[model samples]
Target: MEYVASLAFAKEKDQQDPLNKFREHFYFPQRNGKDAIYLCGNSLGLQPKNVKAAIEQELTDWQQCAVEGYWAAKNPWLYYQQYCSKPLGAILGASQQELTVMNTLTVNLHLMMLSFYRPNKQRFKVLMEAGAFPSDQYAVETQVKFHGFDPESAIIEVSPRPGEHLIRLEDILEIITKESDSLALVLFGGINYYTGQFFDIPAITAAAHKAGAYAGFDLAHVAGNIPVELHNWEVDFAVWCSYKYLNGGPGAVGGAFVHEKHASNRDFVRLGGWWGNEESARFKMEKGFVPKKEAEGWQQSTAQVFNMVSLKASLELFEAAGIGALRSKSEGVTNYLEFLLQQLNGINFQIITPKNCNERGAQLSLLFLDKGKEIHQRMTDAGIIVDWREPGVIRVSPAPLYNSYQDVFHFYEIIANIASNA
Candidate 1:
């Protein structure tokens, strides 16, 4: 698809977009009294128009039904996970029995590690990418320490070649083979936050299994941006936060996936809570912890219904739009963005994201050679809401659900103007 550098072309694309109606369902932020082009869904998504009503419904249940609301609410608070799992499972490519909404992203990461990262003296090392999200780095560091191993010795970081920004798949597979004797787990971010490279999950999972190690992923960047088959790939476990691409409000409830093979193992070692106990036995309040034979068995507390309401509301939109259709729109719009950016002159930057659409999602990470912070500020002030990371990378994500080709064109226009002045 050839991209034109004019606003008319962008508007024409938006007019023809089958997903255009979705843009109206969200409330964008205001800058200079107009809806800002919101390109920061990679950070925090814009609020869905229905979220307020969704929260109000819960509040009304609390007021009218009191504690009975757990059983009587429109969406039974007692079974909130089911409401979330149905739609979320579709986007994540898993069965409802294999997924659950629970604690935040890092907390779920810790729980998955505790259950899966059993290490013997011979095979105690954890293999991961060099620059994972900081939370993952910290969690893995502490988990290895808790098990009485030196992090430097127990953690194998697969780095990119010195001059390259992305890690090579061959290098990761080769390291898994070389360190197979001591490797206990292969954990990775589905898409690296900084570089926006979508790793090959199925290949990585197979390699880890062949090496006699468990494979897991933190899918915070991948979950709603792209469709993934966690079950088909036979990923042992995966975790994600909902606020980014899922369009749940800030700090929304997080989700987790445990393959049927692992979720069905009631004897799996994990921190037990009443919510995780078998429903029939839960009211008895007995001593023995008979866990459910599903992913909900990992729950450590009662459902945070208020926190989860936003995600449930957002999933309605996902159910309507479908993740496959969203990905198709994403590839086209993101490609248009790339094309427009390349047409810009005098900008001292390089797109660090993988060029292949299959190797990325809706994001493009621009690594600037100079005054990156200043340029980012200019973008924000001009009502273009992209995010900047340290070491000079600005993340521009046009979420297919709400953002438009016009949004992308406006972003390109701002950058081109900034380049001209610089």
Candidate 2:
């Protein structure tokens, strides 16, 4: 598709979009009696309108059924999270038994590390991208320290070479091969949050397996933004939160994936709780832990019904508009944004995100030579919602689910004006 020249052209494209009606299903935040041009789904998605009904159903059930609501409500609060599995599995490309919704993002990461990061005397090292999220870095460091290993000595942080914006795939493969004897696990983000770089997950998984190491991913930024095939990729484990692209709510519950290959491995150590016990035997209050036979075995508490109701509503939307279709549209929207950015010649702005479509999702991380934060503030004052990262990067994500081409064109128009004045 050619770059759109005006806001009217963008509106024409929106009119032709098959998923255009979905925009109405969400609760878009407004400023000055007008809908804000929201382009920050990479940070937090807009709330779905159906979420209220879902929450109300549970509230009504609770009032009428009381204690029986656990097993007797309209949707059965006892098994509320089960409703999430099938749709979530379809989104992540895993079987129902391999995925479950529970816990927060960092908590799930710690749980998976307990089961997957089995460091020993010889192979006592972990490998991860150098610039992973702060929460992930803390989790990994704490896990390393828990195992009596110093973070400086046991963690291998792989970073890009000098003056490069992204890590090279070949360089990562080389590290995996060279450290095969000592590496215990390979953990990485499916999409880097700052630069919006989408890593080669399948290739990285295969490389880790070849080196006799476990492979895992933090899909916080990639879950609803990109297409993933965790089961086909044979990833050992993975975790993600729902607030960003899933639009559940702020600090919403997260999900986890444990490949079926490890499902029956009773010897795999895990941090357990009563909720993880097999449902058939759970009420018996048995002395010993008899865990469930699937990924649900990782659960440590009762389902958070309200938060999960929000997620169920959002997942239904994802099910209606398949992730593959969304990703195809995302590529076009992001590429169009890039095309518009490139037109501002001699404007002292640079795109730090990877140029190749396969290397990114919907976000474009723009670096300004001067006054980056000021430009971001100007866009916000104009009722445009973009995010500013420290040290001079601003991220604009035109979400395929709700953002329109007109929104992008208007943003570029404002940006061009800002540049002219600067």
**What shift in Å separates residue 332 of candidate 1 from its native position after superposition?**
0.6
Report the C-alpha lDDT of model 2 over 1-422, residue by residue, as the tens digit: 66766777888888888887888899888976899989999899999999999999999999999989998999988888889888888779999989889989999999999999989999989999988989999999999999999999899988989998799999999999999999999999999888898999999999999999999999999888888899999999999999998888888889999998886565568877888888898899878887887899899999999878888999899999988889888988898888888877546878999999999999999988787888888888888898998777899999898887877888888888877887
Q: Report RMSD (Å) for each prediction in the order shown.
A: 0.7, 1.1
What's model 1's TM-score? 0.99
Supply candidate 1's per-residue lDDT for 45. Answer: 89
Top-TM-score structure, candidate number? 1
Off by over 4 Å in 1: none
Please, what are the lDDT tens digits per residue for candidate 1 over residues 1-422? 77889999999999999999999999999999999989999999889999999999999999999989989988888899789989988899999999999989999999999999999899999999999999999999999999999998999999999889999999999999999999999999999999999999999999999999999999999989999999999999999999999987889899999999989999888879999899999989899998889999999899999889999999999999999999999999999999999998887899999999989999999999898999999988888888989889999999999999999998898889999998
Point out the worst 10-residue segment of candidate 1 by lDDT: 73-82
